[model samples]
Target: MDELMRRRVYGADHDDPDPGPRPGHVYVELVGGPLDGLLLDITGWPQDRLAVGAALGTELGKFGPGGRAVYGPTAAGPGRWAWEADSP
Candidate 1:
């Protein structure tokens, strides 16, 4: 599994620093939903609009960083988000 994906294997979201920066990973959560587990990071995307991707069986993505494309599953969006410490 990719380093990013590996970090998620723990089944628990880890703590992140800054919450906004290159060294930081993006986390995505629905504006209002019930499902909550691993908060998906939505930073990999460009900084401009709200990108929409998958999370907890829901389709949601936010656009940021101009227009980069960041996406993931909602089923894993809720808790604290952090990189695997060795993510490429």
Candidate 2:
């Protein structure tokens, strides 16, 4: 299976961060929901924006068309983010 898919299906240990991200880019792995295991770049975002997370629009979510998948930073897990909810 794909690495990200494996991690999502097989649990957290599969999140192997061996080589890590390219230099100068800040990435956070989104866990759960339709966007699970997707890497989001938050490189130049302000602290407030980072704190509030994002309402990302996607067609794959439970809400179907016009839906947004909300994800927020993982307080206990830096470099990772958690799904909050889905809204249409």
Candidate 3:
């Protein structure tokens, strides 16, 4: 589990204050199981309070029990989320 945040480009022109560590994407990994070492890049979902939850649900649904695993945001900050399966 990892929270992928956009890094500031030193040469980019911008007027807004640095949006420090804004949530960009999440990388989920399964540990110690048949699905171990599998990685999922969950992004492009609606960026809202429920984005992570929605993404997790969608992925798990697609993969089923084997998809059961723990995950966390790529970065640590507000709105960051984590989930774990009952088994596996």
Per-residue CA lDDT of candidate 1, range 1-88, in tens?
A: 1433433321242364322222366555323332233344555566443323432322221322232222333344443322211111
Q: Candidates' lDDT values, in order? A: 0.34, 0.73, 0.39
Question: Which portions of model 3 show Cα errors greater than 4 Å?
Answer: 1-27, 31-34, 49-70, 74-83
Worst 10 residues of 3 by lDDT: 3-12
lDDT for model 1, on a 0 to 1 scale?
0.34
TM-score of each: 0.25, 0.71, 0.26
Choose 2 or 3, whichever is better by lDDT: 2
Off by over 4 Å in 2: 1-22
Provide C-alpha RMSD values for all models, in order: 13.8, 7.5, 11.8
Better of 1 and 3 by TM-score: 3
Q: Which candidate leads in lDDT?
A: 2
Best by TM-score: 2
What lDDT tens digits, residue by residue, belong to model 2 across residues 1-88?
Answer: 2453333321223356643344566677888998886777678999999988888887778899889999998877877788999999
